[model samples]
Target: MMTTAAPFRPGDATPTATIRTRFPALRREHRGRPVAYFDGPGGTQVPELVARAVADYLIHHNANTHWRYPTSEETDRLLAQAREAVADLLGAEPGEIVFGANMTTLAFHLGRALGRRWGPGDELVVTELDHHANVAPWRALERERGVTVRSVPLDLETGELDWAALEAALSPRTRLLAIGAASNALGTVSDVGRACALARAAGALSFVDAVHYAPHAVVDVRAIGCDFLACSAYKFYGPHVGVLYGRRDRVEALDAPKLAPAPETAPERLETGTLNHEGIVGAAAAVEFLASLAGGAGGPRRERLGRTFAALHERGQALVQRLWDGLGGIRGVTRYGPPPGRPRTPTVSFTVAGRSSDKVAVALADEAVFVSNGDFYATTVVERLGLASEGLVRAGCACYTTEEEVDRLIEAVGRVAPT
Candidate 1:
């Protein structure tokens, strides 16, 4: 069992200094300078508590599930606890949580299962702004199951979803709607609740790729009304693992491919083979760490997480605005995604005129300011922006990101920009 950490209070100031100490990677140096990790949209740095939880699981309770042995029983208990932790984070029931290798893998698995019910003339709705993980799976279904796939267009000028196009794409034949809560490349927060409601009205299932949004917002599965949702642990300061939440009735009905002897259950039916036990433990610890930020002792974990994300969202907004303004001021830099005042994650993607994204990222790395370059698996978004060959540079804020780091990144980009 994981021990409770000290509680924190909601509306309290962000404990930036204290939080930075929990991540050892923040101390890393590159090229004789302290490293600044602005590559949070790619993956955030994990906390010490998460690492310790993984290590403890492997060192002490390393065993498979469903056996009479003590270690096996412990493994079962740990998995259950991990489910509950993730459930609290997403406002879902423990039985609704399913663990897998990562978001892409889980999405593909779901596509195969969901496709079993789809056929020719049936449609799957996708978006131009989504990461390929959400697109490719549904497209594959089109080829394998002869299901028709339609896309919702994106408005390049504002970096927001074109809701009118989405409305046109939905029909009674639309079997499922695959959408992203936030664009991984451009950081545009979509109207997921409205999209889900639209799909429901059309008698279609909704699948949400929340891998980018989960780290930044308080996700309520019930509020969104999505039939299925997927997120990655690595995006939220945890080990590399994917979590999927399916409505109980929907999950129970899926004809997922599995072994005969495997436990036939809603979540278990979707999860194939043995899971990464240590990673699951680490994921639970990550959720606990987020709850601790709120500091409401003796309160429900879900309530604490709600408060924590509210505080995080406020702090992230200020940091992101600073980044947006700083980057916008730099000559030759063209920013993408929603502007500072709009609803979006604290992620900024931009390109410098006369410079490739990869070259600019390399220049920043030399100064120990790390940011991601290229399509970031959102190839369609890149192509739609007419940046297929020259992908954009992405910088995102995290729990430990500071104003100094953001300033450093801006300065580095300015120096590297074409004069």
Candidate 2:
């Protein structure tokens, strides 16, 4: 009786077009070459669907929400659509989804709100694998509110979160645990399910940063049982925006220092001032773009999620494995995270032994291969691995990336490896 699930095929036309079709800008070639985007960890290249949604919002529904005019009513409708779309994307309730400018700002806002609850002697358990956005807030709380910020070390060899360190770090005084669902630098997907359970047992709330994880796979906050989750739209092939999901009760109870006239709603209260109606509308379209990749609909919720994600996952694993194997075969590339054919996203970071990360980035750029270099805002990881001064070069793949693209990158990296 389920009508939402869609059967997935390896090479369905609809999904293939959704994966390959690009807007004019995204398809624009510089010097007669397509820009191969391996910078997905930072953000994704938007499709025509998302671009059209943004334009449609600005042209047709330009007014702010809840106003009296027709434009305002349309804007309100768009807002509702945005909420529903984002909620469905993360398997959350519409009332639980809150909009923000970006994940870093949202995390800070949420942290400040949560920080109010913890005073002197209260502790926050954080990982060395998290971005500075997740680290600095708790450290600030420690300095200002007399709380203790404890660091949970990582297993550098495996590029994984150290559970023993995390378990021992938590105590009755622990108030929070901020962990990334996947390492932005290393692409090591952590066990948020276990982390959430541990947080609950330790009488603490868990915040999961899914900004990196959202694009590669499906996110079910309820399944993971985390307290707060944040991810960016740009990272997921949408416009530049962020989504924050909070349990209704917890969001309602946050003593956020907001305007006197702020709406007393679970989501609206946390949303603060005016939102990016256009970006949000575009985010809805982005979700549509992803769902469209699920083939046609006629199955159960679990079945649908499973079907679509299986295709995406297989594609991702293949591309990642190809890149890993290709890089490994060549000399001087010390790649991080799970090995080739491992259960991880296709985001890879590595050092050239003889070449600087900046040099590798520059060499790739010359060939119209766009990749990133440096910590990627995952400051704690870079510092932990002595890659802070000059970060490891990163070449990340998306659902849109092809086998041909990975081969090109490997060939280019090999040629540029200090030869």
Candidate 3:
């Protein structure tokens, strides 16, 4: 018989009190009020352990790789360990993981490298719901390598992709399919498995942008069957670092541009120049922090992480539902994206009828309820919604987010909603 997955109940495995204490930033106050970070979609607050790991790396193990010195050797070992840690989180092999400055930079680097193999007849498929980081890099190939970038339309009202349009875009000429696992702007989760499967049938390689999805769900590279996937460390409770996971054979075959003397390997071949060694070390610590949320006792790191994310996802869904329902009840407040029961992240975007998004954001900030405003680098989504000029105010929930905090945000937005 198939075994049931480990149980990860909210109160049993990861209580709010136990989880909140781990983040040092939660102690911070804004204008005498304790800060509630509802801006996790932009970047998450780092935990003490992750910060300590960064500092420890810089203080004791700071050096270049492949040297005779002790620090250099330690640096090499730390990097390997970091790779393994990230690999475990993604359910991928260590060699398949590549480190870079951030997801955008890595995407550009990969796009340029991949562009080398294609010419005028090649096409790339992208969706309107994706963040610009996923859209812009492939679009660049159109100008540089005569690539035709085809876009899949989004259902603006539902905040979901048009699957029919997606299928129509994936012709045999489609060289690569670039899609986001979740919409950072609308919180809509796409069917990445379906997208990847369709791309495979069309003989097209698939690249999944999982930056927003990583903190909210479990990622299995093998299960998704994507050729490549990318996410940012800062999007989770880690330092500012970018991670890319390419399939072993695909990564090994890429003609990545690197220094002549650099180590020529699957991951290192894609990674150029000296990396953010401290940040990489802290990124691993962040993954460990997530694993620890499920108590870290019974199983391996990956198993623990699976349990932890399951619990976090359940908690986040509850909080997001409260926020969504609360916002919907307020006067003159127009909420965007899918409703509470839909497949989505713990992110909500909305606009006050008479208030610009920036004005609402500033008003909320005065009450120490921090949130993000504007397109959030999701320009296409805003333009498609016809709110390009005003954009949308976004509030996202993190692991430490409390029900009380969600109530406060709802109360604050109610106060700012146009009469």
Candidate 4:
């Protein structure tokens, strides 16, 4: 008999009181009021442990890789450990993790490498819901390599992808399918595993942008069955660093542009120049920080991460439900995206009538309730929604977020919402 897994309860993970102590940013006061950070989707506040990890690496073991010196060897070892940490986080092999400046840079580099294998007759598929970071790279190939780019339309009403349009976009000539695991703006979660399977059936490779999704949900690259995936460390409370996970064979066979003296290995070949050694160390620490949230949970780091994410997902759903209902009750406040009880993250976006997005954001800032405004690099989504001029006011919940803070945000927005 098939049985459903039990839902994660608050007791399964660490308490918010303990979690709040790890982030110093939560203590900051703005205009005599405690700041409520609803800007997690743009980037999360860093924990003390992650900062200490970066500082420790910089102060003591900072050195270039592969020299015979102690610091160099330590640097090499620490980098390897970081890879292992990220591997556990994403359910991939350590060697498959490639470090870079950010997700956008990594995507551009990968696009160029993959583009070299395609020509006039080749086609690439992307989605309207994707951040331009995912779309721009592949689109660049159209100008540089004469490839056709097809975009799957988003269902505005449901805030989901049009499966029929996605199927129509794929064919034998399609070389790659670039998509996002979650929408950073509206928080809509896509069924990427099914999308990847479709790409495979159409004889195409799949690339998933998980920058926004990784912080909210557990990412299992193997289960997703994507050839490549990219995420940023800063988005997940680490220092500004990007990670790219490519399948072993695909990475080994990549025709990436590099110097002859650079290490000609699967991952190192994909990396260019000296990496942010400190940032990479902190990235791994961020992963550990997440796993640590599982409290006394036993077994491997990956299993602990699974528990932690389950609990976080439960908390996020509760927050989204409250946020959605509160905002819906406010007059002239129109929310965009899937309602609660659907596939989505804790992030929510909306616009208040008679108020521009920037104006609303500034008003929230006055109340020390932080939020992000603008298209958030998902320009196409805003353009499609016909809010290109005013943009969107986005609020996101994180591990550190509390019910009090959510209520404060809703209250603050309600104050400025048109009557």
Candidate 5:
């Protein structure tokens, strides 16, 4: 169904010096060689610490919470620590964080619970640029709650959100505004602060999916002023886990469907049943690993966490810029989002004319460079761009990505381009 693009080789060069001094898990061997992962939008490879924590949680503390036994108490304590870690990352109260299988599950649960409050003619705005994790749940909510779903359009040519269009979509009845921190399809980081402001002015709850953006950008729910935000730890070098950060008041206000008998926790109410405790522990470990990579704070716990997040932002921006520059110079390639030298994070999406995206992905894989080649669950954006049927290649970067990896991917892209 597709033709392969040209082939390119990754020439040998001394790797970037500014590499992670740690991350043995990421430096994993495949066929006796170091692996390179540019498919961060899909999932990030975790660090050894994260893996160790997961294994440790399972082997050493294999018990549920709240039991009178020592193991159960320990499990509860570890989880409490994890909640605090997540809260520190989002700059929110630990009680404000909710755990679930992944972002989609949390969004669906939150959407449905919040949907109970909506009625006919009420409105919600979902951006075309968001992954379905953020879009579908709201749409289901609209159908169930008699609310109207409004879609914010985009400038397809540049893969940028049409801010004016988004403003027009807002109204007094907009009960919720669903947006993504970054486009998993186009790598376009939305103006979450601006969107949140508009939603607040309309008295609507603003929920953002930072899943794709988390590895490449910094997230602070307080800074964005969002009512709720969800992201997957797996997308940021942890286990396959989802985390939700809710404004303390907003989370407390919503009565998510749960075992009513269960004690009311801002997060626990929404968390519902027993969860993947091991994964939660792993997620916390991943955050710790990233915080170390983030630098600027080898000091206090909370202060170091904040410093680490900011540092990731700076480093991610630099790596992404190099990736953009490398991809921009290639012929027949049309890039999406923030252009080559913009302040956007390191995830880059683009299409090679005349070659199907699936084929392009394979071509790159042949050169040992991995990338995603589909709607990437960012259905709305693709449908809006009329590329729903023909997705593009997405080569994203995480905190651990190196300049050599970027160069190898760029060179591979040039090879994958079919004439």
Candidate 6:
């Protein structure tokens, strides 16, 4: 469990103005208007601090790990520090953190490793609400290893997991329950703790895809009681890097494919090769940047992070509420997912009548309101929503997102909406 910090009050919150200034991308102008980045769910803009950390590592500490040189030692230390930062971010031990190219790669790697032990008769449970990264990896195990993969149905009306279906899917043959902590397309935050508990009760290990959820909430792996969890740093305000947390025993026991000369340690053995040293350094800097937002709140890094997330979540709730209401009032705008007050992230997906999602996004972009459009790799969710052709226009709120920006997005979207 994370150490409790003082609850975040409005007075304790960092000003959005101050946070905006830290991201250089906010200065960008598009179509003569300042770009209001609503594509944060796809990838957040990196703060200058994170960029500087990456540059500094490349320029000064460019060396391989664990050699007799100062730069090499420094590289090792920086990598370790990166693990420590991600550990605090996910409420796991530093040694349990593994770095890879991205979450998808890590999940696929883990899927292969776990599949080596299971064949026909062993089962894996995936979800229709999950991003295909979580679904496809385990499904690959079916084709390769002959494991029967079951999918938990999605509740279309509520944009939530079908709890009854999920419960029915788990059985004694289940080897693992792979679930996403949140739906990237719909911002539906699943009850992963409950999901993990069910998986545990069924005598199955659980793997959580936290890539979308980590940016919006504080992830406590222990509280979730999952055997493994994966998140991408880029989903937050960091570089393009994936982090995985594994139980020490689970990681050490995996028959992961690695070079014979590679370190046989739990975490390192999971990582395929020499990692992106600079990206990993920047990832740590990203965690530091997030903690710094708590501003003078003295506590452990996790406590500060908890405070920051608490404050940001409050801000996100308001922003999403405004966006939801504004779009609801507009003609031809059909919003998807759970409405405001539901357990969701500060992300919204919608479609404008008579306009394809891409066209709506293009029109919004012309007005300098950048939003993402498409299945967003949560293809199953979109397919389940029966929006296979129209897709979805997604706008996500982040720490730097402002009310003014939210209003601008609404206005821009209004102009594009069919009267």
lDDT of each: 0.93, 0.84, 0.94, 0.95, 0.80, 0.94
Query: Could you give candidate 4's per-residue lDDT for residues 13-58 as a string of tens digits?
Result: 9988899999999999999999999999999999999999999999
Give per-residue lDDT, candidate 1, residue 138: 98
User: Could you give me the TM-score of model 6 versus the true structure?
Assistant: 0.98
Candidate 4 off by > 4 Å: 1-10
How displaced is residue 120 in candidate 1, in Å? 0.7
Q: Which stretches of candidate 3 lie over 4 Å from their true place?
A: 1-10
Please list the residue runs of candidate 6 whose C-alpha ends up more than 4 Å from where it truly belongs after superposition.
1-7
Candidate 1: stretches off by over 4 Å:
1-14, 296-298
Which segments of model 2 are wrong by more than 4 Å? Answer: 1-18, 23-26, 298-306
Measured by TM-score, how close is model 3 to the native structure? 0.98
Count of clashes in candidate 2:
0
Worst 10 residues of 1 by lDDT: 5-14
Q: Would you give me the overall lDDT of model 6? A: 0.94
lDDT of 2 by residue, 178-219 (tens): 888988898888889899999999999999999998888889
lDDT of 3 at 109: 96
What's the true lDDT of residue 204 in model 2?
Answer: 92
Candidate 4 or 1, higher lDDT: 4
Give the Cα error of residue 158 in candidate 1, in Å. 1.0
Cα deviation of 80, candidate 4, in Å: 0.1
lDDT of 5 by residue, 42-142 (tens): 98777778889999999999998899998999999999999988887777788998989999999999998898888898999997777888889988976
1-419 per-residue lDDT for model 6 (tens digits):
78986666744867899999999999999978999999999999999999999999999999998899999999989999999999999999999999999999999999999999999999999999999999999999889999999999999999999999999999999999999998999999999999999999999999999999999899999999999999999989999999999999999999999999999998899999889999999999999999988877678999889988988888999999999999999999999999989999999999999999999999999999999999999999999888999899999999999999989999888899877
